[model samples]
Target: MIVTSYGKPAVVILSVEESERLKELDRRVLRLDEMDDAQLHEMIAAEIPPELRYRIEDIPETP
Candidate 1:
């Protein structure tokens, strides 16, 4: 169950299996805000069953 600190107050209910799956994904996946585009693509490729390799692309710095 998830509780919100702000916005409309609500109660979230999850089955035991659903909760476990969500926790597993959270433990394995990096937060999008923490990843550059290349890193995000690499993670996606890695998750596929048949395995795909990707070259890392440099992120240009913002002026």
Candidate 2:
């Protein structure tokens, strides 16, 4: 939930599980942001190997 002050956002409230998940996502985004353009492109273009097929899972639903 969002808390507002004078028509502006002031604070956010999240469940413990939601907070932890957001923290992890933040960490991942930070790591990606640190990468250079070439590195980011390489990662984006990389193909998954057949050997790792068993590790793939369905995408998670957005909250």
Candidate 3:
């Protein structure tokens, strides 16, 4: 799934092929503010082959 939040928030669910391609996106080294919880969830959900996904808020602020 592809999701982006620019205020109203956008969510796009992808097929297995697209999900595989989306896994290639690098997310470990990006700024927190660059993406919100929903976007992050979608990206990470695709990137990591997780059995279950979790939502974590309360991340520290960037300087």
Best by TM-score: 2
lDDT of 3 by residue, 1-63 (tens): 446797554988778887776676653457868888998897777754465545566455665
Candidate structures ordered by lDDT, highest first:
2, 1, 3
Candidate 2 C-alpha lDDT tens digits along 1-63: 989999999999999999999899987763777899998898899997987655335556565
Cα RMSD to the true fold for all candidates: 13.5, 7.6, 17.0
- Which stretch of 10 consecutive residues in model 3 shows the poorest summed lDDT? 47-56
lDDT of 1 by residue, 1-63 (tens): 566667754878899999899999889876789899999888778753444634456455555
TM-score of structure candidate 2: 0.46
The parts of candidate 2 lying over 4 Å away from their true place are 30-42, 46-63
Using lDDT, give the best candidate's number: 2
> Where does candidate 2 clash, by residue pair?
none
Return the TM-score for each candidate structure.
0.38, 0.46, 0.23
As a whole number from 0 to 100, the lDDT of residue 12 in candidate 3 is 84
Model 1 alpha-carbon miss at residue 62, Å: 42
Report the error of model 2 at residue 3, Å.
Answer: 0.6
